[model samples]
Target: MFADGAMVLGAAVLCGSASVVLGVLGVRLIDRRISGGGRAGMSASLDAPIQPMVFLFRDGTLVDATAPARALLDRIGPPDDDWGRLMRWIGPRIPVAREQMQQLARLGRLDLRGGEGQGAATLRLLAEDMGEGVARITLCDPQAEHAGIVVDSMSLQAMEEELGLLRTALDQTPMLIWRQDAQDRITWANAAYLRRAENRHHGALGWPLPRLLESPRPVPGAGTATRRAALEEHGQVSWYDVHSHRTGDQTMMFALPADAAVRAERSMRDFLQTLTKTFADLPIGLAIFDQRRNLQLFNPALIDLTRLPAGFLTARPTLFDFLDQLRELRMVPEPKDYRSWRQHMANLESAAATGHHVETWSLPSGQTYRVTGRPHPDGAVAFLFENITKEMTLTRKFRADLLLGTTVLDGLEDALLVFDSHGQIILHNEAYRAIWGEGEETLCATISAWEARIGAGPALAALRDALGRAFEDRPLSGAMAGPGDRLLGWTLTPLSGDRAMLRFRAVAGQPVPGRAELFEAVGDY
Candidate 1:
């Protein structure tokens, strides 16, 4: 234990001594550069030529650097490691420098010269290990201007050239870029910003240029924020997306023109309004759902048809929720139970997404509604609700009237059969069926078959010819031999709706209903 404590104590003392020596050497290097020379017989001008750039790093941290070296670091921007930027700048020119710098403790020193050319190629780098994990890097250029003892003119020239490049880039860019100080005062602006600001105000802007935008300035450490602002120029308002970034006590602002985006938004809004107006005037209820099955659009008719509350619809409920509302209102077809209703709703959404779906909703209130779901683009679905109650009522009444007419025709003692314009059998009375046989036999009976069944006399042949020709509007009568030689009277007459009726009766029954008598109302029976 005693020996371990002694070893630690000795190591701490050695580290403290190394730190002191390093600080003293740093001060001496700075002093020598500021003065005329460092080595004996070396003049300031001669030393400048040999050492155009110098950097001192201790434990991977930049302790000090010449003014020219500082300017070069700024051009490369921020880096996590202090020496990383310098290593990157020198790596391509002296590929071995990176590996050699890592092994600096073993190598002790390094001298590298680039190719004969301008920039990093024509450069020379000298590295010296100052022990205790400290290193000194010296960059030299024979062609660079280094007349001063303190600062290298070549570094100054590089800084000025870099500044010119940045200036030109900012001026050519179409966006507006400006800087604001701690008090939100405009401190700097690019050429694009100046041109717009001056044109808006109709005058030239001096130092600390005007703050054209009214957005709130970002505070230091706030990172970045973006919003929209407007600038009016000669009664014309122009919009822009303003981006603000704060660094320390100052804020940098940028503006990008947003006129095209704003205009497109307004146009879409207007188009929707027009469509809404058209839908509002339609009699059919309309409801549209997007791909997410959420009700995105609905019309006034939907509320009237479904009896749904306006608030629930405006809340943008899902498709099932809308149907649930209808179910509660008894507007939809009643399901056998809630379980089946849930399944039906699921199928409805699936079927609608795939293709069109139609359902006849018979409400408990005796109202009939036709609900149709049509698939639209982008997986959307449109529903149309139509009230078909009146049309349905008319159809039912027509069916009832036909049933009554058929009953009256069947009650007649004569056999009657009705034929359409196409000579196809459409209707026949019970008496006709009794005489012509029932079912398939009754359907097989034609005028010629009837003539053979009754005995083909001259009068029967004339009647058969009359029936075969184009049915005339006039009434025609004839006699034929009935079964067991019984005489039967037959008459053919035209009926309403492009139909013809042929009737057969016993020769003695009410004299076979005269032409005018056959047309008599059924009440006479």
Candidate 2:
């Protein structure tokens, strides 16, 4: 009976140990299912086609993330060990979704959506309480569902193309072109800009724009803040007049002011030089004088004509010395009156106080000179001399031509009247005046009154009407004849804006026609 009792006790102990082992294993299996299965369910929901998800704990630890979230996270790198630290660093960098995350954390369960990736992605944050201090979060992405994208794309492309064309045009232009960033850094420059010695970067691409501008030479209008204001306010092109240093040439880039880029197509220097070169090269004895009666400058032609050494004509020569030299050379007539010569000197002094002075004289050699003296911007004086010998000859020839043409027209036995643009008589031969029973002066008055008297009839009225039409339409011409076929041929010729000429001729006995006939007669005569 003692042996039986010992065996029974051992069997009971073994059964009790087995029961405890099975119970412990069942609890462990249930825990594993809860943790792993819960995570899997959350992952499936986050990965839905229309949704982009990111999950974080209350402390900001990234627990789970979707494909789109993963892409953004890649750019920022993985979060740090401390969740709070991660949130603080990245929250401000992303403009969107930051506020949403903060709001969601405040509310136990929150749903919020926003933009990401330069408006390419949409982010959604959804959080739910999982009891006992746990939470699940989800994010969403929606970039494909938006309108106005096509219009935006086309507008952006057009703007980009226009900018590209503008850049190309500026680069090809002769003047230097450049742009600076807000920090005064040289962001871009063209070929002409790079060619400048100071602007060369020695294999480097860019330098500070302010450094380039800090040379001894002053930028025009730089003392004022106009250029800076224009850059900030308009963000459009602005101009600056610059005097830059050249590499080998000693001629400094003197004050070249340019317009806005589009208006800078023409070269101002070339135009000015072309206009002035001919005047500078004329063979005349010319000299520019200052207030002190001393020579300031003279052209090459003047120097050659006068044979005066350069050093002798500096800014301190006396007027008496100049005139004495001219008199000794017999270039000028002997002072017929010394008093008049003195008077001329006094007049020059008086004229300097008032304004410019002009005078003309003829030399014994039949050469004539017209001299004009004008004040300069720098308080100096400029003298312009023109040799009028050829002009005088031309004037004589013109007078002869005019007289000959008049004689021929008068001999033609036709009544001719030439009126100005306003139908006032400019010219009427003796025959025309006689036909109207008026003198030369009377003819002018009579023609003036005829316009008011006849209104719009044969002679004066027809000429006025034709001139009005020609003035309206450019290069217009028309003819009119009288009631009895008296042949009052009228013509209209435009002189300038709203101004025309009316010529009338009696077309009896091979009538002298319009202004064309007058010109032809002059040429033939």
Candidate 3:
């Protein structure tokens, strides 16, 4: 019951020979029934083939398989057209199988060894050409040629179903998966991985499929690590997030698509750079804080306006800390007390959170800032600082000039009235109101009263004509009767900017000053 060299048999015979015998007998009985007992002599003659596991192919099709070979095919679970199926299984182990199988006719015979498989053993294949496009492939385990073992049909069938289920799941997943040995050699790959390898390697794809990712070779027993890698095809770059998990003496790798995530991250980085360039040239100081009240962004103007160092600003201080820094520099208005200052700051933050808020800060250094707080997206806030010192100074100077002019005009004793080019009265002194008796503040009544006093003479008529025209820049003088019958000298003068001024004085008695030597200082401006 034993072969001559049985002592050199492998564990495959000790573990699986009985199952192979049963599988061969079952296939032979079915064949005999189908061939109507006519092929009994042929079946008897070839019941046992060479190599314990052999396949006979004529015209690239399987015509016969040995007993051990039929058992292996049963385990692999392929249909009648199993040449392609056998090639796929052998590819990882014997990478040259597909390439060299085509050259077997010219070469006559070939032998190859595959990578290590389960139970820490290598598989061997012997291929030979029988001429005329006919060939035979013999797969043998050197350590198990003389041993035999048994397995029930129920157990085998259950194993086949479970194997099919697992294969389906692995092939159906869109992710690329592969296993590598301790030496970083690819041992096996799934359908997705093969598809990618095919696209890259094209017709040359076979055993141990080509590596698709430039991913880092994971160190042995380093646990799991993830990284991103790039793959280029058809001039378009694709990205993947590769995960490598190390187990035992091998590493299992998975790669998922990351093209979208990479693009989004690139876009966000470009947007921030653009915003930084835009903010660099702004004149207004800008500081932005996030929802947690930490300073997230600021412009160069903020550094210049606040006089803060770039290093400190880049450190990303909290809002209160930033305010404290500003306070140390006397950049904010001096507070009433420490506690009240803090309370005011809290109120400012609350107000800014709601919408728009504004505060004017007058610093001890005499710089005035118009500070505006505006609400931003995602519960963030932005502060803008604009120096309004020059504006404030101009406004104060204008108010002072108006006050000095009004004081001088009201102190005048001579009556004065000024009219715009449209004949509308714009300015009148207290003396003019006193002379006209507080009626309508109009010029027509004053002219009529002057005519009544002066008897409508030609000189008075000329002065009236000059006043009415309101365009001539030269002065005209005339006399009107005073209350005590003294001569009241009146002047009508056209001023700059299309305005007219009428003045009245005592011509003989009121010459007290040097520039008063000039005609008729009514309001004394």
Question: Better model by lDDT, 1 or 2?
Answer: 1
Query: Candidate 1, residues 466-507: lDDT per residue as tens digits?
Result: 676426768888877664465678898987887777787878
The per-model lDDT (C-alpha) reads 0.77, 0.52, 0.77
Measured by TM-score, how close is model 2 to the native structure? 0.33
Candidate 2 clashing pairs?
Answer: 52-139, 52-140, 52-141, 53-139
| Tens digit per residue, CA lDDT, model 2, 367-486 | 776766677654566655567778988998999999988888665445555545454555656455333434233434654655543344555565555554655555544455443344
Per-residue lDDT of candidate 3, residues 254-274 (tens digit): 999899999999999898788
Q: Which stretches of candidate 1 lie over 4 Å from their true place?
A: 1-170, 179-188, 213-228, 243-254, 438-445, 448-460, 468-473, 482-486, 509-525
lDDT of 3 at 466: 66
- Candidate 1 lDDT: 0.77
Ranking by TM-score: 1, 3, 2
Ranking 1 against 3 by lDDT, winner: 3
**Among these predicted structures, which one has the highest TM-score?**
1
Position 445, candidate 2: lDDT: 66
lDDT (Cα, 0-100) at 421 in candidate 3 = 78
TM-score of each: 0.62, 0.33, 0.57
For every candidate, C-alpha RMSD to the true structure in Å: 19.9, 25.9, 15.8
